[model samples]
Target chain A: MSVIILAVFAAVMILLLVGLTRALKSPSTGFARSFAVVAMVLLPSVWLLAMLVYADSEMKKVSFCTSCHEMKPYGESLHVDDDESLSASHYQNNRVDKTKACYVCHTEPGLLGYMDAKLRGLHDVRVHYFGKAPEELELVAPYDNAVCLKCHGEAKSFLEGGGHQYPDTLIDALKAGEMSCLDCHDLAHHLED
Target chain B: MVSPFQLFPTGPEATTRVLKRGVVAQILGILVLAGALFTKMPLLMVVIIPVGALLIALGILAWVWAVVWADAG
Candidate 1:
């Protein structure tokens, strides 16, 4: 499927090149002129649209996020069999989409969440390549409980789970920003001391 | 008996200029995409996607300018 999509793009590229060659002509008339217009403008526009769609789809993949050298360890942690690792347990238990586990925990709720993440990913790229990276990896901001609550806040199992204590009070604290889910669930990448 | 270049022979100087600009824009767009995806520098996509759209716009303008002006003489 991927190969076929690529082949289509390649064909389009070839057509675009042909269009460009035709466009170089000084004086075209009638049908030739019309073909030049379509080739030069319409075809390239379609190709660009397809490129954006392709990029968006690729961004959603776990492989895309973890391909970064700095992110490799964090990606590996997801596969750890230890029950103590929060992210690993989630992966092992199928609590999150394996393909989009990063997004599951990271994306805030709402339309802006995806856009925000994409922007953040851009920032990551800049920092990774052009900026002075930190000696140790850290979240750019403090972790937000809201990201967790987006999924588990209303889930029956989470609310009624034995592990939670006075769930309402904890949730209130979470909302008030007086508490952090990470305080108890601090195994994000499980970096060693 | 048709030569490739003659198939769509080079346009007037104005047409050539517009087409050349379009070609450059398209090349820049491709570079943006390569920098973004291949180097794991997705920040470049912020530039790439816009450049792609820009290429489309330029291509249209080039075509229109050619039709209205280049061929007028």
Candidate 2:
């Protein structure tokens, strides 16, 4: 898909070069003017929009998130051998798509959630470039239980777990955001010391 | 009643100048867009794409204005 978009962009740019050159040489010519409009204006508008969409999709991949030096440890954390590590467990066990592992856990589902994640991603890029990066990375906000419940809320192991069943209201508390899954399952990412 | 000439004074020099500006903008926009697309970096997403799009839009507007003026001439 990336290759295809790049190929189409190259073709459009070549056409634009030809049209713009002709239009510049003969600004009074009707055919050249029209060709310039189609090549320089219309084709590029469509292609730029396509590129934005492609960029958004690319940002959802783990590789995109982990491209920065600060994010390398988090990416490596996904491969930790420990089963207790939330990211590693989910990644190694195929709970989420490997290509989009970071996005799956970080982004809430739905349009607003997706937009919020993208905005945060932009902020991250800003901080990475212009501001100080912390020695240890932290979430901007507490990890929401809702993200976990989206998948685990109905899972057999989660529902049948002794800790959830013992208090009876534990599940409801979790659902209502009164309890955090991390309280018990705290080894979210065991980064190497 | 405003004549089209009053609204968009047409001369070969004016057409050439405006068209040159438009072409320059389009070329710059294309370069920026190409850089963003090829790099696929998050920084480029924030910085490059918007700048490229703006340049392209300005170019399109200039080209249209030049075309209209040229036709009137």
On DockQ, the leading prediction is 2
As a whole number from 0 to 100, the lDDT of residue A135 in candidate 1 is: 74
As for candidate 1, its clashing pairs are A24-B10, A24-B11, A25-B9, A25-B10, A25-B11, A26-B10, A26-B11, A26-B12
How well does each candidate superpose onto the true structure, as a TM-score?
A: 0.72, 0.80
Please give the lDDT score at residue A121 for candidate 1: 82
lDDT of 1 by residue, B1-73 (tens): 8754454334467667766676566545544543434433455555676766676677667666666655653
User: Judged by TM-score, which candidate is best?
Assistant: 2
Worst 10 residues of 2 chain A by lDDT: A50-59
Judge the docking of candidate 2 as incorrect, acceptable, medium or high.
Answer: medium
Residues A1-193, candidate 2, lDDT per residue (tens digit)?
8688778888777878888678778877888878888877888788778877876677788999899989898899998899989999999999999999999899876788888898898889999999989987889988899889889989989899646887998999999999898999999887986
Give one digit per residue, the lDDT tens place, for model 1 in A1-193. Answer: 4465556556656766666666566336465466666666666666666677777777766787887777788888888777878888888899888888888888777888778887788888788778976778778678778788888888887777846657668767876778998898877765433
Please report how far candidate 2 places residue A88 from its true position, in Å: 0.4
TM-score of chain A of each: 0.78, 0.83
Displacement of the residue A78 alpha carbon in candidate 1, Å: 1.2
